[model samples]
Target: MATLTSTSVHTSNLFSREAIAEGTMAFRFTKPAGFEFRAGQSIDIILLNPPETDEEGNTRAFSLVSAPFDPDLMIATRMRDTAFKRVLRDAPVGMQVKLEGPSGSFVLHRKAEKAAVLLAGGIGITPFLSMVRQATNDKTQHKIYLFYSNRRPEDAPFLDVLKEVARQNPNFHLIATMTQVAQSKGEWKGETGLINEEMLAKHLPTLQGPIYYLAGPPAMVAALRRMLINAKVDADDIRTEEFSGY
Candidate 1:
């Protein structure tokens, strides 16, 4: 993991934007010269003199969905019906925003020999997406297994992109499952139901050697941590980050 000496702030303008998933929007910004960050890091985006403000404030922190190797800095979020998102969603192409960070320690372990099992729920997949993309680009030898879960495929961001990444990286494993396939209009033949001990055992040979990273709603992260502990996985092998309000 790459640690930094200090945090810096910069002004970046919105250059492009798109809807990555249902009710989710990804905004791309100009990467200030010399601005650098490791995969799995997060940043805070502050609205500059927005047309309106709310109790939620004008600043929001988001995981860097784009990999370090990518040319631009990018972040995605669920477009909640709030003043912040409203202004963000409607902001013009050249709208400028304040950025502060490259924060959070939710990065990959250094041991390449040990496998990495990433458990991502909903938008929690953002950071892991960067990690996997970087791993593929760097040709890292670490085995990566991403188990991304959502209510349905439509709600799961970057699903197709992950599939392509898996196809390109031999060491990357992708296990995408949905909790509510019936509600989805698209057909899915992949795994269904919540990820559990049985589900993990089915794909992984032995869970003891792998380091687990969990990201999701607070409740989901807590539940997965408990499941890992109950399954005899070492406490030291587990790391967690809860994603909320985004």
Candidate 2:
């Protein structure tokens, strides 16, 4: 991705705060321009550094966690890296960050409306968070299923939010899987395994009327696409976003 270089900022500061869990911080941001976005789309973040660049330059991409219908633009960072961790933990509120987009085609199009299956792993849950949130807010009529794979319950983002949305909407189903449950917090009794075709079939039996939206590491996304195709899903019905070289 090309860096956006200019002194001007495209959006205003709506939120600059952190939500903490499992020693990780998820940064949230918002702006007023009506902040229009499709449910599963993402925005490129252009962090300004007083003209200074990071070890790999000054910009990165992040998926919006807040619903498009919501009044704010939201994104969460894991705070795992030395550089990002410091910024999320210490950055003061009201600081300006450069941003562009609300871009990407991972959003659910109308043609595959009867059913939609969303697969996410770890921080990849960000985009689907927006999709499910928007679906509930708008009262979408599509049958939506979420296959969220995390190391443990504590490792996934927005557990309560996803549960709440699933509770309110009959068309929405949220299935969470933990790859390493032994190291997880107590009281964790969800599905345990990797997100592969067998696990997907167990939770989401059929993709007959559903279009699949996948986002995660490059290998995960690519592998899941192949799984869906092998399961008889149309190639065009699967959309994805892989956050590689980050």
Candidate 3:
């Protein structure tokens, strides 16, 4: 794995906010001049004047959902009733936020000869969304296969955007699975059940040289990692990031 270097802390004013899905909000902030980060990187954000604090502290790390070329820095997170999240979700425009270090090794391998398989669960889709958007915007020729899982369509963030991206980018493919198919409201026409070896084999043309990326809750990440290893995937070719809590 590669090491990431830390940069100077910067303060950014909140530009805008919107509810992207149920209990989830996308926050856009002014990007500090000269600040740059690779797709899939995350930053530490601190509410300048939070209404309250707790054992979780005032700062939270979130993956950058905005593309590198975007003028504003953006992140999406589930709006739990926690003190930190509550303050973030209710903060108004022009609120100043402290941002520190854009650091992470979970970025795409631009020069890889094989295809990339991205496995995301729930809100874990944030980083992969960043990578896919960047790849599409830059017109990079990296072949990407994203397998995103959620309980319901309403709970999945960026579902519509990702579907549109796949439609426009020939090199990118998306396979969305719903674990709670019984709860589906309408006629759903996509893969169902948790991602497993059979599902992978059905979609992946050949798994010979593909690299796998997994992101989600701790248990989900661990389970997927083991599943990949059991399928004879090289350990070095698998990368993962665990999103602990809301």
Candidate 4:
């Protein structure tokens, strides 16, 4: 766990909200003056005067989807039928929300000499999206390879933006896979299968020195960690953040 030097809380109004994918929404909020956070960090969010609450509480931690330079604070999540998510999903513009502590160690190492292999499952792509956007905007020299898995294109969040980023940033490569192709609709051209050693090898021929970042459901993260270890990736070189539930 990374320690935060400051845990000061701030309040901001919801500037806008829109659906980015099925059951997922992208929210932009007013960025409090002097409120700063790294690209991959997460903040605790509390809906002020939420409509409902349960054993899960009224607050949730979400990765900052917007870059540090962006004027608005942004976060995205699947709109589950839970009370918290429902309140957030239907939250009106101008609603106030509490934010605290931009904490988390799941950030880019800024290693210019080494490559970064990012493995994301479903909504786990949030933090990686921020990092990749920052890297692309700054034109960082660090190479990045993103392997994002989802049921299909419609269920995958930020697919279009990521593809555009890959196109704009020569150092950034995207390998999007669909695990449930049979149930997916429309034309599919990308790879179809669960992420495995063979897929990694196919995209990353020489993964000896590259750092690995895994984010997704607990089971997926655990499985990928085991796969990477089996593939001889150094344990110290891999950093992970697990998103609970599917």
Best by lDDT: 1
The parts of candidate 1 lying over 4 Å away from their true place are none
Instruction: Give the alpha carbon lDDT tens digit for every residue of 49-161 in model 3.
Output: 68788998998988889988889998998888899988887788899989986888889987746799999998899999999999999888888999999888888899999
Off by over 4 Å in 2: 1-9, 50-52, 82-85, 111-113
CA shift of 196, model 2, Å:
2.4
In the range 92-188, model 1's lDDT, one tens digit per residue, is 9999998998888888888899999999999889899999999999999999989999999999999999999999999999999999999999999
Backbone clash count, each prediction separately: 0, 2, 0, 0
Candidate 4 local lDDT, 113-147, one digit each (tens): 79999999889999999999999998899989999
The predicted structure with the larger lDDT, 2 or 4, is 4
TM-score per candidate, chains pooled: 0.97, 0.87, 0.95, 0.95
Which residue pairs show backbone clashes in model 1? none
Cα-based RMSD of candidate 3: 2.0
lDDT (CA) per prediction:
0.91, 0.74, 0.88, 0.88
The weakest ten consecutive residues by lDDT in model 1 span: 1-10
1 or 4, which is superior by lDDT? 1
